[model samples]
Structure formats: structure tokens, C-alpha cells
Target: MNTATASNFGVAASAGGPLLGDAEFQFLRDFVYRHCGIALSEQKRQLVQGRLLRRLRALGLKEFASYCELLRKDPAGELGELASAISTNVTSFFREMHHYDLLVEQLLPRWLEEKKGGGRLRIWSAGCATGEEPYALAMVLAEALERTGSKVDARILATDLSPQALEHACAGMYALDRMGGISDERRRRWFLRGEGRYEGYACVHQRLRELVAIQPLNLLHDWPMRGPFDAIFCRNVVIYFDKPTKQRLFDRYAGLLEPGGYLFLGHSESMHGLSDAFDLVGRTVYRKRVS
Candidate 1:
């Protein structure tokens, strides 16, 4: 078929007629929004046609509407598969390094001082695809604490909606080429080069890996953590959510944070009309109101 309309949110509008194309796209769009609260736009039509065509052919279902019917009925675990196909999982080690730099330069000193008073340090990495960010945070924590001889208990919760992505994060392996922008010293200290069967990859060192616990979590679903978290890195994940969802999510983040705890969102994301419980600290960084 002609693969023209699919976009980032998975489903696209049908360019042609009402029979198969329109029905299939509508089915997918509705299903995704119902499950994840993501809004599908018309610009994604070509993308939907392109990405899901192979599946349609493989199932020997000639008409796209057939797929729609199956999804509408919520057929046997297929919805999860569709979500996996549509969710964007792009990530890397040390992405947008300034955040990490901020952590090291500003946050760590304060964290260390807090730890001296027996404060428990907890960091939540929401939308932590394949575990890179949490592990990186762990490395920073370990290095800083060790240098100061501060005995502080710290843990990172690395969560994502994709179980497959969580599995990759738990495995702690990544393409060596993806390490290009990471500093050589950081790379050498935190990652180990794979050998033999996995010769082309690099894996996070055990010390850092042990600090992060990867779990499957859908942001749109009810959260399971009991927390007054010290910091939360919810970067680059809310751009797809609708206004109401974003507002609700920010409120939830506020509820879980400790007094004066920090919240870090994506570079493009803001709390403009979302929540007033936080004070903007910097670009995409917010400090929870403490009184």
C-alpha cells in the first residue's frame, strides 16, 4: 500500500476514502488515545499507512478496516503490541548534557549537605527509556559521594511504559557508536567494552547499574510509587500529552515531591498553564513550593 501519512503519535488521517483507510486510521487513533491519552493529528496519516502496512499484510488481512474491528474489540493483547510500535523510544547516554552538568555543579553540593543530616536521596527518572539517564545520575552520585566520604543512601527509579525497553535498560548494553558525545573519561569510568559475542557494544559498569532499578510504568496509568522524592527528571516525555494530561501530570509530580524538591522537564516543555505549585528554577527546571 501507499505509506504516506504516519507521524510520531502512531495513527494518521486517511488521505483517500472512507472504507479501509479512514476506518483503520480512526480505529488506531481512538484506541491509542483511549489507552494512553495521546491525541493523534491529521498530519500522521502517511506514517500510519507506512508503519502498520507490513502487519496488515502479514496477517493476510487485505483491508485496513479489518484491523480496526479487531482493535475496537480490544483483541487479545494486540493493543499492547500496537502501542509498542507507535511509541517513540529515541534516547542516548548523556543526552542534553547540560542537565547532568547542572546536577554535578549545583545539585550535588546541596544533596551532599542534606545527606550529612541523614537525608535520603532519591531520584526518579520518568520515561527512562533503556536506562541511560538513571545510570548516568548514579555515576555522578557515586563519584561525588565517594570524593567527600559522605555516607548517603541513594537510589534511582528508572521507569518506562515499554517492557522491551525496560529489558534493554536492565541489560545495561548499548551501541558503542552512541557514545560519541560522551566524554572519554566518563565513558572509560562508567562503561565496559563488550567482548566475544557482543564485541561491538558497551555496557554500563556494575557499580552504576546496581544503583538503578528499571521498572515498567505507563505515565498515563496510575503510579505505584510511595514517595516524597528529592528530585524527578521527567524530561522529554510530556510533549505528546494533551493540555489536561500535562496539567494533571504536573500536579501528580508535585504531590510526590519532597518540600523544596526539584523537577526537571524537557527543554521544549514548560509549566506555563500547567501548575502553580512549582517555581521555575531555570529552563525546564522547577522547584516545588516549600513553606
Candidate 2:
């Protein structure tokens, strides 16, 4: 009966389809917040409706109520698709170049030198949207290993909530246009250009695949791996989280990181006042306190 819900009903009725009633919207908002840790305001009602319309069409669903019912019935199986529909997975290779610059110039070298000779180094791309971030990471890590001739067992763990994104990440393929952020030398070094019917696409090299492990994960849920990860790249991800959710996630991240370990957030995200376990080390970067 609120203005936004009423306006939504009027719009949907004029378009001649089942509407997302107030009850259904409330249920959905609560469900997303509870399970996905994403707080959906009344304002996002229309955006959710607009994004979910494609899912409705794809699922051959005639009513938003049915979609809600489907969620109620199979929340875990469909959670990825729902999260994907609601959120934009805007990512690219080296999308934030400074983070990579820090890795290439500083972090990787330091980790390699410290962990040399049978040491294990783990870097996690926590919201690795379509393989770009992890592959970019692999490129640098591989170079560091080669440059140092180190025998460190270095690996990258790339995880995301979207099944579609995780699939793309596992495939490690991209259109040539998506290669723009990559330097020409890196393109030649790290990717194999496709041929014939596969033209205009390129796939990451095998060594990069060997360096990264792709898995589908919901960050709001339990993590399978117990890690003292050296660095975690969760860039541009927590902006959707509410304050409490951010606090819980940051605490969990602190629990999983080594002392003095690094966490890279999107340029816009800050850990200010959320957790005392870290110190702001650089632009949107936090380092776990040694204590």
C-alpha cells in the first residue's frame, strides 16, 4: 500500500502481467538480506523487478510470486542466478591497475623472496567475476616465479557467487576486445589466440590455469578452505553490503588472513570503523595488524 509498491502495481497492471505485490517484495527483500547479506531497500524494488524480468522470461514464469516460490523451494540452487540477475558483474583484466602495479612491483617480489624453497603462497581473488582478475594475478605471479627462480608453491584461489561468472572464470576465455587492458606483450605471453570459427576470442594459457583454482562460493556462507591467505582481493564487492554485514565480513576476513597480510578493496570501499584488526596501509588497502 506504500507509494512505491502501489506505483509498481499500477505500472505492471497497465503492462498486463502479474505484479510483484508488497508481500512478495518484502519476502524477497528479507530473503536476499538474510541469505545473501545484501540489504535491498524499497528503492531497489523496481531495479530488482527490471533485472528479474529476464529471469522470469527465461524460466517461463508468468508471475513474480512464482519466482519467489521457486526461491523458497530451492534457495541454494538458484541463489547464484538470483544474485547474478540482481548485481552487475562489471570486471575486466587489470580493471584497477594500481593494485596490480603494487603486486608486480612490491607484493609478489616480497612474497616470493620470503616463501622461497618449498614455501606455499596463496592469493585469493575473492570476487573474481569472470577470470580476469585471477588471470591478471597469475600473469604477475608466474613472472615473479620465473624472475626469482623460486620453488615456492604459489597458487591463486578465485571465487564468486555467480554460477555464470564462475563458469566464465573456469573457461578462461575472452573476446579480443576484452584484452585491451592487457599489454601487447602480456597478450602474446599469456593467452592463446583462437582460430577459425573461434576467431576473435582468446583463452588464457595453461600455466595460468595451473596457477588458479576456480570455485563457486557465496561469501555470506561458510568458506571451505581454512586459509592464512597472504592477500585477498575483494575489490568492488562489499559496496552492496550493509554496515553490520560489512563488519561481519571484515571480521571474518581478518580471521582468515595472516598477521600483516594484505586485503585490497575497491577504491570506493573503506574499512574505517568496521574492524580494528587492520590498519589502512594504502588506498582502500588494509594490512592485518601484526598483533
- Badly placed stretches (over 4 Å) of model 2 are 1-5, 8-17
Top candidate when judged by TM-score against the true structure: 2
lDDT comparing candidate 2 with the true structure = 0.90
List RMSD in Å for every model shown: 4.4, 2.0
Report model 2's TM-score to 2 decimal places: 0.95
Model 2: lowest-lDDT 10 consecutive positions:
8-17
Clash totals for all candidate models: 11, 0
Model 2 clashing residue pairs (backbone): none
lDDT of 2 by residue, 1-291 (tens): 676877765335325556777787898899999988888888888788878878888999998889999999999988999999988899889987988888889998998888875678999999898989999999999999999889899999999999999999998889999888999999999999999988999999999999999998899999999998999999999999999999999999999998899999998899999999999978888999998
**Candidate 2: Cα lDDT at 149:** 89
- The C-alpha TM-scores of every prediction are 0.86, 0.95
